[model samples]
Target: MSVSFRLGILGAVGVLAAGLAHAGWLWFAWVAPAGALDPGSAAASSWMPLLVQGSWTFVLAAAVGWQLQRSGQPLQQSLALLRQQVQALEQGRFVVVEDPPAAEALPLARSLNAAVRRLQSAIEEAPGQGAQALRRTARRDAATGLDSRFTFIARLTERLADRGGAQTALLALRLLPVQPGLAPDPRALAAAAEMLHLFSRRVPGAFVGRLCESDLALCLPAHDLVAESAHSLIAALGSGPERLHCVVGCADHLGGVSLGGALAQLDLATAEAEAAGVGALVCRTSHREEATPQEEGALRRQIVEALRANAMELAAFPVVDAQGDLLHLECPMRLRLSPGQPLAPAQAWLPVAMRYRLTTQIELAGIEMALAASARDGLSRCVHVAAESLSAAGFVSAVRSRLQATPQAAALLWIEIAEVSLERLPPRLRNAGTVWQRCGARVGIEHAGAALLSLVRLSELELDYVKVASDFVRGVAEHAVQRERVQGLVAFVHEMGARVIAEGVDEQADLDALWALGFDGATGRLAGRQGTAEALVAPGSDAAACRDQAMSPA
Candidate 1:
């Protein structure tokens, strides 16, 4: 039954056969002839030869058995090693056999190692293809490839109920029917939608949706881009003489209201725009405070005043590991637009800052704050850099000069770029990432996984880590499909030599799920405090709130 037992039986049979052959030879060569002359002499001669043959057989059998056992050891060890590697592969771990136990196993090992390399390559290079698959499975409006009305409403409702009391701006566009009862031309409608899609892509955290056959809506959180974006759309449409009649309206949502109420107020603004004529834009506050050019001019003045007074505020929220050990503090920028007003986060004033070409200045100010805090507190601090600042002529050099000045603080700083920026401007991001890394600060991308194709580009940059977008992290706890996607993302990022962190992880279930999925770190409501702005800008407080809101359904 056993190999050893079978071998022993065959060895014993071979030895007995050898002895019989020797006895026969002795009988025929001497005993047979002698038997005719003297029978007793022949028998005695055969017995002597047989005894010699038996002795040799025993020696040969022992030597052969010992040799077989000695030769099998390497093979046994090789088989065990192969089994372990296979088990690791089954567990979603890519591994290779670096050294074969026996010379004969070399070919098998090489083959397995090649397979592992291929798998790693596929994961590292196939993000775009994978994202296409995700898009196919996700719900989207066919014409515009944006969120459907129902989907948009659901996400908007969620943002409205956010415990963080996030501030949002809701913008709606209406394409009027040509005749009283006739619908707009399909070609014209499609063109307008395409234009809106392009606009949405430019805004870092803007959500656009096809609200109906004749209406499209956009949501901007902690964003003041409603008026600017609406005017841009109207102007873009007006460029063509044959453009359709369009009206745009936006309203600020400071929370504590129903979706219906927000929509009603938005409707009022749209009606006002429609009355102004084709290609008109209007803005209203939740309480019907009109946003006029005078207010706009006043905001510009306030921005200048704040910057002159050095009113940039930085708040640090902790990013932690599974053991609750601090990894780094995520610092979101805030500013005091008016002397007496509570500080406002980037989302509220960034559009105005960018309009005035002050984004680079604000970003540099935030970096300085983060560096100072890191040095003072002896804790690593992170600051996000806007895409606009990266392209600003002297932004990088300015930061570089500052980092060079305070080597210790630079060592403790982490700079992050939005994932969208990386996708659109890989070369620029790479250049910035390289500069920052050389200056001793870590560089990475946040709000990642929005563009899976960007993963391939990550190899082009010197990234230390990437933060998974909150959209992917929000409901991973109970959704198997989402968990699978997250798992794949983790593996790809790990293979590319960058750690993965989860963003917007505000729930315990999501946190536990992320840990199980192998996230390096996480930051959100549950991971640590919401920092100073959220604490100071209480939901109902009269503080000037700047809320950042963007919702992309996965």
Candidate 2:
């Protein structure tokens, strides 16, 4: 109990003992002796001794009890301090007591401090771990480990967004022997996934995914031997015990074709394959007359020569902050094969570059060009690095050495990897981002939000900023739901300790809405341009109209 109460109890016990001793002495030495002898002698001799012994005994016991209680006070105080620290920890405050009141609690305090440190470390690594888990559970088929339909579609759309769909080849496969209205057999699906996974290994940079209940698809660089891969896939399907039949259709992404248009072409090819019969394969070329082998070789040689000659120019665009101040210049490479030929945007030639395995070399060259321009212009510039290049061997080291060589230019550089690619190489990106940052450059993800859950782990990538894809930002000005999403995304990115930027701000109204929603910066036709005299949410504008419509339901 308390020191005061314990001491009081001890004092009472001492007083009782002292009283008992006094009573005994009185009976034997005072009362009994006085009755048999002279009263005055007995009283005079016993009274003084009795008073001295009782007083000394009571005082001595009380003094010793008080000392013991005082000695325990430090320990009691130390326990209270520990309790406070533990409460703080429970409340998410990692406070520790320095110099605990008593040495008895020193070891416990050290242990508590160590626990706090460990928890902090786990929290720091949690985002990346959580991101990976999300990709597995949310983005992939549970059994197949292939991207979910929605995730696959998003990635396809992103890839196709580039010019000529980056010359991608779409291979669609339909498993046969399906009962009408019934789902495809899981065994067949799993077997198909396994076959596709193995076949993909033979095709570099090939991506496979389950697109429908009985249909699966793979996309790769168009220059790959699509017909041969399809044949191999069909043969593998027939080798199984069930002799499962499959129809394979291959379509090359043609320039100027929309995603829907490309899918339509793929569907036509699949229909043709099915009509040809089960286990049949059909191929659709981009042109009515496919290029000959010599023509293909000539184009490849030209690209190689162009790369060797370093015949590309960079087109810089401004990404600006909320106040319309320039944040950086996005310098995308524009290839010019000959002095007479006009510059071609990356979309026009990237597919060819990818086909020739020249992306790594081309991207590296672009980085060098951007850095040189940054040095000369003294302006901050951003360069987009494709996922292919990032995974290419020696790419990171080459960029690191180049950045190190031009420290000043590196400091002014911003390197971005696509969001779709980010999902594929977080660990590599994590290391690369740190190296780039240390070399005075910043790394980030562009075209983000394809996989919403993956954004939660942005901190794991250690990026400087995240650029939200235009699809999400397109009509946020007129859609209340979109505005809410953008706002939440901005807050989430901020919590992850990275700025959020809006890409493809085509309309002034959209840009205004983004600015109000707390976007840190943005790029597009409308960004970096002066705002109109009217308020951001002007009357009769889409933003105001949307607000009114949302409140109308009330």
Which candidate should be chosen as best, given TM-score against the real structure? 1
Residues 7-85 of candidate 2: C-alpha lDDT, one tens digit per residue: 6566655665554443444455444433434435544455465556556665666677778887888899888887887
In model 2, which regions exceed 4 Å deviation?
1-291, 531-554
Clashing pairs for model 2 are: none
- Model 2's C-alpha root-mean-square deviation from the true structure amounts to 21.0
Instruction: Give the 10-residue window scoring lowest on summed lDDT in candidate 1.
Output: 545-554
Query: How do the residues 404-498 of candidate 1 rate in per-residue lDDT, one tens digit apiece?
Result: 99999999998887665554453644577788789899998876764343454355465799887665566678655566567777877776678
Report lDDT (CA) for all predictions: 0.68, 0.66
430: Cα error in model 2, Å: 4.0
Residue 316, candidate 1: how far off, in angstroms?
A: 1.6
Each candidate structure's TM-score, on Cα atoms with residue i matched to residue i, is: 0.51, 0.49
